[model samples]
Target: MHVFLPDGKQLDLQQGATALDAARAIGPRLAQDALAATANGDLVDLMTPLPDGARITLITKKNPGEAAAVFRHSLGHVMSQAVGEFYRAKGHPADAVKRGVGPSIENGWYQDFDLPEPLREEDLPEIERIMREILSRNLDFSRREVSKAEALAQFGGDPYKAELIRELPDDEPITFYTQGDYTDLCRGPHFPRTGALPGAFKLMSTSGAYWRGNEKNPILQRIYGVAFATQKELDEYLHRLEEAKKRDHRKLGRELELFVIDPLVGKGLPMWLPNGTILREELTRFLREQQFARGYQGVVTPNIGNLELYKTSGHYQNYSDSNFSPITVDDEQYMLKPMNCPHHVRIYASKPRSYRDLPVRLAEFGTVYRYEQSGELNGLTRVRGFTQDDAHLFCRPDQLKAEFLNVLDLTVLVLRTFGMNDVRFRVGTRDPENTKYVGAEDNWNAAERQIIEAVEEVGLPYSIEPGDAAFYGPKLDFVVRDVLGREWQLGTIQVDYNLPERFDISYVGEDGADHRPIMIHRAPFGSLERFVGILIEHYGGDFPLWLAPRQVAIIPIADRHNEYAYALEAELRAAGLRTEVDDSSNRMNAKVRAAELSKIPVMLIVGDKEQEGRQVSVRERTPEGHKERKGVAFDDLKAELLERYRTRA
Candidate 1:
């Protein structure tokens, strides 16, 4: 048998050879660096035996695939060893602590442990000391392939390990990784020695997480740590973290008075303040006008809908776990809707349609609720209840591709309007092995084909992500990158083949036959709350000229100029701009500072000279200085503001 190497070299080998064996056959140097293998496109361990013919890509430290997973999984074991040693050194038994699953995730890894006592922030330093000492030991590593019974015996005294071992499939290898005296039940291929791992590990935070992410499960202390290939990488990541903290929308929101999340009102609900509400309303108005111009009709839907509506849309079937519990009315049940598609579908079905009316776009600012975990709740990014700038397009099969491009164009316009030009697209398709998705294979294939053509014909830069699609359809997600370089999932466009079939939605074709109308569910701003949060951080709470809640704030220097300030405010308001006047006897400089702190785009000052001349002094919000007075004609200033508002930039 032969296997094609990454460099297109063919290596003749036995009919059944493992990746590890293949690596050893190549060279000793390659064997030392080999971590795992990518058979075709799937990630698999080196221990797994290969078939007769295959395309094999060897994974090493340079490849962040199977190698990274093995490395991080081994690191979790190291962490557990450190904790156990720390407890033993304190004359405490290891069995007193409860251990949970430790998995390697993006960036680094985290492990959950139910400690005898709560771990303090100060304890991380000591824990790091122990971890470094173990790393310095340079322990030799080995893997053991054993039976389920043998694996259970190896970890029986350790309840968590035993539980994990019990869950392993009978066909699986049931392997273990061990370094020195420390061992863990893990699937491999990890580095040959502990010394191979880079010495740039740091414990970042300690938080409570449920065991296996179930709220009913025991609460465990989840210690998150980040590791890098070099000290420079670690330092740069730490700096990014600091920058992220500085750009935290929750902190900036409070400081800028943009929005508020009060605990008394419960978690995950954001109450937009006066200034923040202005921002929300402005965004809604902009989107509404855009939809109106794009052949869309805006409709209003209730905050909650009957549970049956969700059942018909398959939300009850696919997303029941994430949705809020039903609001039962006697024998009947109602659910706080988790999505806007159902209501929009009802609106589409409310009227008769034909192939001539191929596409009908229904838009709404739909608010929905989810059952987010309390611990996962943040100010606005991860909220239980939020508004979505949602729209659903019901169109004939022939019109699907064109309608998709239209939605894509609208989404691009929405993002570009606010200067959010740094964004990437993810084309989410179904997982081949996942049976939970709702569509028939033919319909799914047709919808996915049209979407791929639409996105590609428009020349979009995107990656096709398997298993990331909504249960009902293949979708495209618009991901925004903020100032801090954090990616935020904002808008989404889904081509749903399942919902239309499930709801039995149809239209009269030109052939005088009843046929299914393909549904395209889209939300330019996936969640208005999350979008606003990302936008705040992206701009550092300094909104664009059009989106600024307080477009202009007028300040009167003295009682004599108060009338002039009022007059200036009226002039601005009459020009269709939002304006406010600070008539209090506060210092003019102080008023200006307040306006700047609130991130107001413009400030109008009225003093003795301005009041007499009937001209208001204008100071724009610029980085260099605040008192950058560039007095212009009041009418001219109005025209510039109107231009910015109209352009939405």
Candidate 2:
């Protein structure tokens, strides 16, 4: 067997040799340092056997993108072993601790176990100690494949493992990896030896999770752990975790009075508080202005539509699982709309005739509903009901690229307005092998090519992701990195031929014939709820002047100055600024502290001297504490704030 390296070097090795052997053949240091390998761009464990003429790139700690998953996954196995050992040491039989599936997730790994005793948060330390002890043994991880019958027999007592084996396809290999006394059913590319793992791993927490995420199944105690290739990286990640905790949207939402998820209202349903509603309104106003200027005609649609409407648009058949159950009123079935495009399509179909109206841009701040699982719901980010900044452009084929470019321009403007300037793009195309997509092959190819060309022309950085396209179309998603360097998918523009075909929507062409118009679905702010959540975390609850729920807080130094503070608040509000006056009996310092904690961008301190001068002392709340910019004329302050608000600074 032969394998090729990036440098075009080839090595002839024994048949069935793994990537580890290939690395060793290149250099002993490379073999020892290698964490994983990319075999033809597909990530593989160092233990994965290389095929003849395969291209392999050794993934060391330096390539954290690929190496992190391998490291974390191997750590999951170690944690599972440690958990089992901890239980056995506590007097439970070795086999009494039944292991469920354990897999690596983003930034970490988690393993589920059906144990004799429930795992507590306090047990993490002992589990970590056991993991370290196991690491010290330097035990080799040996892999083996077994038949279904053998695997079922081996794990018969563990119903979870037995069920998994029974469900697996006959052609799929049932594999397991063993390290000393610990063996687990897994198809893995693991570290050759226990010592190959870095010591920079920690058991984070534990929680109850159903086996295979099915509520009907037996609940298992799941332990989560995060690992990194180096201690510095681990420290940095932990620091970020701490920062994330401080910026968690749920916490900020409550403390800042942004939004609330009331179980009484329903799970996964969020109601925006006054402050959060201001955020939503301001964002909507900004985008609405942009869309209006770009020739988008705003439209209002109902929250529910006839079930037949979705069936005609293919949403009923394709997205039934995500949609709430149908409501039958007077023998007529209606559904809470999971999307706004179909309604917009109906509006387009209402009155449309000429080629001149080829690019009919219809926009809406439409709220949509989806049946999200309870466990999956988190604050406003993942909700059952949310509003989308949605728009659909029915354009002629020739106008598709230009319309897409315009939509992209609006999306970029919106992102930059919120200070999410670091952007990446992904052109999501249909998987050639996936039959789930509804469009014709040629249409899919054309839509994918159109998006790619537009992205290329705009000179935006992007990658192609196969199988990520919506069932109806190929889409381009804008992935933006916030201030904290975390990426969020904020906006999308999709091209669809399927929807037009399914709905039979058309416009009279220049040739005096009916022609199907390509539908371009776009959401500059994917969902107002999710976008606000991300924005809260990105800005650490300190929004920009234009978007700030309360732009200014006027604090009176004394009861005598309360009237003056109110006057200043009125002036600021009249100038289109969101302002509030602290008229409570609290001390000035306490008022300032409260304002700062509320993340008010500007604090105006009103006192006797300021009242006489018709000026206000300004204190700006920064990432650091408030910076005092002593007395400025009220007129001047208002002018500066108005300018900043106008420019969205």
Candidate 2 lDDT over 1-649, as tens digits, reads: 8989999988899999988898889899988877788888777876667778998888875665557777788889988889888988899989989988888898789998888989889889999999999999998888888888889889998888988899999988789889998888998878777887889999898899988888898888888899887889889989888989999999999998988888899998899899999988988988888988999999999999999999998899998789899999999999998999999998999986699877899999999999988778988899999999999999899898889999999899888877788999998989889888996889988999999999999899899999999999999999998766688898999999999999998899888899999999999899999999999999888887788888999999999999898888888888788899999999998998898788889999989899999988999977666688877999998999999888777
Error of 1 at 364 (Å): 2.0
The Cα error of candidate 1 at residue 114, in Å, is 4.3
**TM-score per candidate:** 0.86, 0.94
TM-score of 1: 0.86
**Candidate 1 vs. truth: CA RMSD?**
3.8
Name every residue pair that clashes in candidate 2: none
lDDT of 1 by residue, 1-649 (tens): 8888988898888866878788988998888787678777666666666765789988776754346666666676778788878877887886766678788777678988878788887988888888888878888667778999989887788767787888889888788778887777776656556766667778888999977777897788999888776678779889888877877899988887788888899889889998788888988998988899899988899988888999888888788779888888978899987988888888878877888886998888989899898878988899988999998899987788889999999999999887778989998999989988987889888877888899899898999999998899999999988666678889999998888888888899888999988899999988889988888878777677788777899888888888777887887888788899998778999998898877887888878777766667888875354555544667777787889788775
Name the candidate that leads on TM-score. Answer: 2
In candidate 2 the C-alpha lDDT for residue 478 amounts to 91
Tell me model 1's lDDT, rounded to 2 decimals.
Answer: 0.82
Tell me how many residue pairs clash in candidate 1.
0
